[model samples]
Target: MKLRQVVPWGFTAIVAVLIGNGVLSQLTARGLTNTVNEVMQGYRVQTSLQALEQVIVDLQLGERGFIITRDPDFLRPYQTAQSNLAQEFARAKTLLQNEPAQLQNLNELEALSNEAIAVLSNNIARVRNGETPSSEELIQGNQVIEQVRVKVAQMLQAESQTLATRKDIVTRAEILSAISTLGGTLLGTLLGLSIVGFVIRQVVQPINQVTLAITSSSTEIAATVAQQEHFATEQATSVHQTNSIMEELGASSRQSAEQAQKTATGAQEVSQLAETGIQAVSYTLEDMSVLKAKVEQIAQQILHLSQQTDRIGNISELVTALANQTNMLALNAAVEAVRAGDSGRGFAIIAEEIRKLADQSKNSAAKIGVLVSDIQKAIAATAIATQEGTQTVENSLKTAEGMAQTFTGVTTAISSVALNNQQISLNAQQQAIAIQQVVSAMNSLNEGAAQTANGISQTKISTQKLNEAALDLQAVV
Candidate 1:
């Protein structure tokens, strides 16, 4: 059970006990009051019985006085007693009504009283008639009066006994009331004290212990929070520094990206130049091939002209031999004419003319031979010159072909260099983009660290307040 519930029950139990004590005392006091009233009633019954007996005595004494002296004043006493006697008897019966046995005794006493009253009245009437009553009548009256006294005495005694019993009961009731009141008060006091002690054990002591535990726990939390706050402050400072470094890194990455873009543009221009060189070298090689073919055709024509010069030399030698034969035939014909004398004069003249013609023909043939020999020598020199010229042309053509091949290789190398430069530029651009992304990530981390630090600081403040509250509760408990 909780403290509030247990404490209330304990106090409620103590109140209940006290209320019960008060109720018992009230009951005992009521009993004592009723016993006292009954004791007073008994005294009233005894007094009434005695008064009835006195009335009878007065009647008898008045009768005796009147009988002895005949006095009118004596009749007065008798008349007063006679009048009071019935009233006194009625009072006695009324007082004794609660006691059945006493009521029966009173009825008997009433009959005897009537008899005595009758005897006393007879004596008085005799005295009034101027004649005296007899001694027997007087004696009889005295006896009856004595009987009344005895009846009164008996009733009185009975009343006295009843009063004594009532007194004893009253005394006992009073003593009992005193004892019960004292015992109840003592018991209620003890129970109330016990309830108070129980409440302290079940509620107050445990509350004190809980308060102490809370105070200690809150204090420890406050210390831990303070340490965390210090760490958060350091974290905030580091984040700020990291953010500065990231800003610088981002700038460097941007610069690298721009440099890569420029390199790519330059590579494109170099590739265009290499393409132009390739076209130029190919065109030069084609023109050299055509020139080489023309030089070879010219050398073949020179060799054909040398062969024609040798045939011309052979024809000149044959013509020179024919001329020599014609000259010898002309000289033999001239000698035969001289041997015939005067009959052959005209024939001799003709033979001499033929000899002159033959001589001239032989001289022309020798000159032709000399010209042919010079022409043949000139042809030989021309053939040698043509061969040398053809060789020079072939060598020049080979060198030109070599130069074309070298130029082709150089163009291929330059094109490869341009392609490589383009690849390098693309790689540099990609690296710059990656660096930029890293810088952005670092900035985000720095911001998150700052937020965490702020949260830790707030936690420290809350812990301190909680510790203070725990201390206050501990003190109160």
Candidate 2:
């Protein structure tokens, strides 16, 4: 049963026990009172019987006193006794009404008392009349008084026996009442104690056990919550740190992305420059080839010029010989003309002019021969320079070809590098984005951890309160 029900029932049982004990005590008291009343009634009956006897004796004494002293006081006692005798008998009879045997005794006692009182009255009448009573009459009165005494004694004895019986009954009732009171009290006490023990065992002890279990469970839960809160706090701290690190990483990635973007742009520019260099080198090689052909053509033209100058020198040599022969012939013609006189003088002047012309032609041929020689020397130098120029042009063309090839390789390599840098920039950007997402996720995790820590802290406080409540319950129990 529940503690509440047990308590009420226990109280009710105690109340019932108390009520029963009270009722028993009351009944015992009532029985004792009735028994005492019976005893008192017995005593009253005995007293009435004694009073009847006294009255008869008083009548005898009054008559004797009147006979001996003639005192009026003696007559007064006698009259009073005579008047109260019937009342005394009646009282005795009422007192012994329940006792048939005692009532019969009282009746016999009354008859004897009446007989004695009548004899006394007769003696008193004789004394009042101044007539001396006879000895036989006094003897008869004495006999009746004696019989009254014997009857009174018998009634007294009967009453004494009744009083004794009633006393015994009262004593027995008192003893029984005492035993009942003691037994009831002891039984009530034991029963109340048993109920208390039962309640303690059935209700209080179990409640204590439950409270203890609840307290222990709450304590453990609080501890677990505290541990969880601590772990959550640590997790939140770690998450916050991680989020910070991720943010730094994201910033670094963004910087790396920018750097990569610049690198890619530089690589593209380098590739473009390489392409331009290759095109320029290609054009330079073309120009060098054209210049090499021109130099070769120039070298050929210079060789042709040297040959022509050689031819001109030969012609000049021939011309110089011719001029020398002409000059001699003209000199001989001038001498013949001088031998012919005046007619010959005009012919001599013409011959002299022809000789001067021949001389001039000779000088011109010499000068032309010198100039042709110089021209031949210059053509030899020009042929040599053209040969060197052709060789230099061939070398420049080879170098330009090599440079074009190098530029082609550099352009290809730069293009590849630019592609790689572009990819790196893209990858860095992707990495930064991924890091940002991770940072965001970490931030969310940190918030969640913080919330969890707060919840755990609250749980710890609640658990502590529960433990305190359990302790309070234990104290109450």
Candidate 3:
């Protein structure tokens, strides 16, 4: 049959056999094997110790050869021995980590090696110069070598006994460790097989069913989300329409407010015009008053001129009376001359000349009266012109006053209009403020709507993620 089909039974038997040979029942056999292995390792250690001892002997021989024959060929063996000695010492140290006494022996060996180096150097120098070696020095060096060899041999025998004893014990321990490891392996294998069977039968089938259900639910959710997208589009269209209507309303309100403001400004200009007209009328009335005062002064001058004309007329009448009296006296003198005859003729002639002089004076007085009468008539005419002028000025003043009154009425009407316009302006300003408040509220609403939309979008994304997480957990379960 197939090896996979045979593996479980075959492995079981192998595990059973290993457990039978293990430490649970074979302590004595394990101890013996351990003792044998320790003996073999100790034999290796002893061989290394012997090699170090031989290096010392070679070094001594090299000294003796230099001292006796003075040959460089003999020193070659000494150098080789020195190198071999270092190698052997390192090998022994690594192998004898638990042997404290052997390490002490190694320290003593190092001292001997150093002594051999000194002795060889001296002997070589002396022999090369053709000097013969002393027998006593050669004998002493040989004795040191022999002693070192004996000590190495002793250390080797002792380590060999210890290694043999430990080897037997190690052999038995190895058998027991093999048996225990085999028993653990068999138990672990059975448990692992049982776990695999349980996972396949109990966990995998249910998880597959749950995954199928979750996939069906996710498909339905996708259909619902497509419907929600259509709804969202309609909602966005509605919001846009609402925003457009609000913009129209805001524009109309702003236009109305501007028109009202223009009307108020026009009313204010009218009021200012009325006030200016009243001021002009007032100035005209003041000028008319000045003209009336000047006319009154002219009338006074005419009255004074009439009084002077009347005085001149009276003086002319007095001159006429004086001329009449002079003529009568002259006639009386002529009558007396007729009665006196030839003796009164010269006096009569002088009286006749006086009568002519009186007549001329009378004529001059009459002319003066005419001149005074003309002056009086002219004064009366001037006075009449002044009266007419005064009446005209009075009429002008009255007209100016009436015009002023009309201007005042216009001013009053303008003031009423200005007050009404101020009220209208205040109402318009209040309406504009109300509209501004509405605009501000609309802006706040727009901002809030944007924030709300963003929050809703984020929430939708988070919900999708949460659904995914639930599906993942459902899969895991």
Candidate 4:
């Protein structure tokens, strides 16, 4: 027989039983574990506390034994008490197997207690054997016992903290689980009752609602499938874009590094050009020195011209003496010319014109002398200017050489940079290629993502429709 036909109620009963039992079992385990942990933790705390109490009691007893009896045999109980503390310590250690801090405290207490016992034993023995007990010795014994008690108390506080933390964690976990189980039980009971009610209502309701719900679920599944395909396409596109950008960046970096190397090279070339220009300027200045000496010789020629002018002035003075005699002679000639007037007039006119010509020649000579002096001065100035010009030129040449060297270095550096840039471009190309590959991969991934999203969308749509159909059934049932 089919399961639903032969034992429809059987399956329901089984599910209810399983769910109820599972929840109950989980709750029971949580409770039981909490109980066990609590018992173990409490036992440890109690054992540690009992150990501390025992130590305190033994300390008191030892003090009393020495005080009252003043006998060596009285020290026996104190000694035995010290020995018995080891057993109590062992018990605490065993109980605190998981409580390391408490066990450490127990060890310290044991040590302190033993020390007090030994001191008390020695004192009691001394007194019993005929020495009187001193007040100082008794006080010292009390102090040692006090120290042990303080340490035990501190340990107890630490253990209590640990217990509280454990208890809180257990309580929260158990309570939460109990609440969950209770909620589950309530939900299951309501659902079971509704299902029974639904069967009775189903007999009267039309079946068309079921058909419509199934059709709607199919439509939702188809829509989900379409969405998934679109998502995959979008993912593929994004992947491609990312890959392309990475390739571009890698290429650009390589280009920049190359450019820097080229610039450094150009700077070195510029430095060399500056040195060459400086050397050329030095040579031009050396030629200017020779030209300056020639200018100085021209100044001496002007000085000679001045001397010649002085000689011409002396000659003009002699000519004037001669001219006076000639004038005397000319006067006698004019007397003769008066006897022969027309012929003499022409001679007189010629004499006047000759005198005027002599005067003009003397003036011209003086002017020529002045002109020579000026020329000499100008030559000197020119020579001075030439010398200055040579120096200026020399300085300018030096500057030019310096500039040329700087420029040459710059050019060389620029060339190198250009070459580096070329290399960078090459690297960029490679990177671009890599990026293209990445983009391709991303595209593939995006396609896959789109497919996955499409699938998820389809699944979600189908699930939603199923849920809707389930809701619709609620109305009939």
Candidate 5:
């Protein structure tokens, strides 16, 4: 608005940028410091674990030498390792005290180390007592020692992973710090240069313009009054154009409001439709789940029917066997009757009929068995098909669930759209009111221009007294 405000505001912008950069740098530096500390701590703990592993190896070597050679002199390294191992473990634990997970691992490592050392002690004591250590005990010690080494390796790997993560964080922090510093420098430099350029354009260049305008204003008062009247008339014309445009804008704003309301209503309808679709999908999913259960039941029933068919077929086979036996007995009876002559003739006929009936019964049982076998096959196929139908229903249930979720999302989006449209309608209505106010302001401005023209006529009369003063000011310039 004025050249006087540029200096403070421009310098303030530069200062704000510097302050923001400093704050960001401070934050990055703090984070970097913390990560560096963690990295350093990790290295320390890793060193301690390596040293502890070495001590364990030395102890194992010393124990083996003493066991084989029976030389107590070999016990010297073992003793030294025993003392150093405890210190190393304590140091590692101290360094990792802040990390609960690492501390837990270290505790386990310490426990295994102690157990291995205890077995080693027992072996050495056996040699001193003039007794040979058992092969089992020796093997147990070696295995436990190996476990210690493995635990140490795992701890080292964990530390390494943590260190790698910290290193990445360090890299990112350094990059951000550099970017903030460089960007702040560039921004400050550009702002300073712009401020200088603004001074030249807004302040320095305008000084000459002001001097020229002062020199040009030595015109006669009559022409200045006429110019004022012409400006007033043009301002009135411009106000008339502005008022017409504002009226058009107001009408457009009202139309926009109506359109926004219609859009909001459509969005609301869409939201309702989405909700209805979601409910339909939910019902379909429920029905599909019920259908899946029903199909499963049907499959089970088909399986049961197949089992019953097998039982029925067995019964049919038993019946067929009994019928064959009965037929054989009847044949024997008919032969006996024929030996009795005329008195046994009726018995022979009756036996002959009994044989025929037995044969018929056997044939009927055979047909029933065949029918049962076919029914079993049909039941088996039905069972398989029912399983497939169950699977299909399950899949359809999953799909329906997905569609229901999709409909839920659509409903949420439509609700948002409806809300946005309502907001747009409200804003349009507000803009229409603002436009009406602006039109009224334009009318007032037209009246202000007329008043300004009248004031200028009075100013023209007053300038007659200032003619001598203008001459004096011209000499001073």
Candidate 6:
């Protein structure tokens, strides 16, 4: 059966046993009181019958004294006895009213007493009137007194028998009350012990078993959560260190790329200056060829002037010989005119004038021969200087062509170094992006581990509280 039904029924049975014991005790007490009261009434009835017999004896003594002395003092006792005897008989009749046999005895005793009193009264009146009474009348009065005494003895015997019967009934009621009280006490004690034992077996033991299992399970769960939280914290720290290293590498790569760009710009400017120098060298070579041709033409004109001065020297020598022959002819004509007298004098004067003209012609031919010899010496020095100037111009044109070829090779090497720097910059940017993603994921895992640890701690506290409550319930039961 369920505990709900068993507990109430057990209490009800205990109450029923107590009520039955109380009712039985009350009934036993009431029966003993009633039997004692009836025994006391029987004793009162026996006392009243004995008092009636005493009153009858007093009447007989008073009558005997008055009849022998014939005195008035004796008559006073007789008169008193007569008055009290009727009252005693009336009291006896009232006490025995429930007993039919005792009442019949009292009636017969009343008739005998009346007859004795009448006999005594008649003899007393005869003595008072001065007459003598006969002996047979006195004998008849004595017989009646004897009959009254016999009837009183029989009534006293009947009261004694009734008193014995009432005592026996009181004894039997006391015995029955004792037996019933002892039996009820034993039955009630046994029933109460049975109810107590049943309750301990059904309720308290099962609750203790369930509480112990819950405390053990909560302890294990709390330990597992603590270990997981420690692992997550360590992982987050490692990810943060990796992210710092990636940022430093990216900064260095950008600086190298900028320096390479500056070197490429300087190389392009040098290539442009070299092309301009080659154009200027070609123009200088053309100007030296034009100057060599002009020097050759001046040498040919000086040679032609030297040949014309030698021809002038040969013509001045022929004029000097003709002037000397004219002077000798004038001298011979002057001597022949003296030998002939007056006719030869006129011919001598004409011959003297011809001799003066011939001397002036000879001096003019000598000055022309000295001027032609100086002109021929200057033409010979001009021809030697023109040949040396033509050899120096040919050596300068060959050196300018070799310098132009060296500048072209330097411009090609600078362009190749600039292309390699751009590829390194691109790779650094991709590595920085990947490191940032790893740092974000580690932070999320750390937060989840902290929340799990908090939940496990709360569960452990609740389990402790439940264990305490179970212990309190065990104490109460």
Candidate 1 segments exceeding 4 Å error: 1-6, 237-477
- lDDT for model 6 comes to 0.50
Measured on C-alpha atoms, candidate 5 has an lDDT of 0.63
Give every collision pair in model 6. none
List TM-scores for all candidates, in order.
Answer: 0.50, 0.46, 0.37, 0.37, 0.46, 0.44
Quote model 2's TM-score.
0.46
What do the candidate models score in CA lDDT, each in turn?
A: 0.55, 0.60, 0.55, 0.49, 0.63, 0.50
* Candidate 3 lDDT tens digits, 192-245: 345334434443454355345434543443443344333333334334435554
RMSD of each: 91.9, 88.9, 77.7, 63.0, 35.4, 98.8
The best-first sequence of candidates by lDDT reads: 5, 2, 1, 3, 6, 4
After superposition, the stretches of candidate 6 with alpha carbons farther than 4 Å from their true spots are 1-11, 126-143, 203-477
Question: What is the C-alpha lDDT profile of model 1 across 367-474, one tens digit per residue?
Answer: 445544644454344344434434443543454355445435534533443353344334434433333333224445456445434533443443344334333322
For model 2, how does the per-residue alpha-carbon lDDT over 146-227 read when each residue is reduced to its tens digit?
Answer: 8888877777777667656765675566566556655555655565566557645753454456446544544554454344
Q: Between candidates 4 and 6, which one is better according to lDDT?
A: 6
lDDT tens digits, residues 1-477, model 5? 443366447655755664565456446545754664576576667767777887887788778867876777778878999989888887887898899998999899889999999999999998999999999999999999999989988988898798778767866766666666567656765775676577566534543453353334323333443444344344443444566665665565566557656656765665675576566657655654654565455556556656766786787789789889989999999889889876555556557756765775686577567655644554454444445444444554554466567557646654664565566557556655554444234555456445544544443333333333223322221
Candidate 3 displacement at residue 93 in angstroms: 99
Total residue pair clashes for candidate 4: 26
Model 4 C-alpha lDDT per residue in residues 286-398, reported as the tens digit of each score: 54344334434433543454355456445545645565665566566556657766544544443443444345344434433443343334334333433433343344334
Clashing pairs in 2: none
Task: Output the number of the TM-score-best candidate.
Answer: 1
- Supply candidate 3's per-residue lDDT for 309: 61
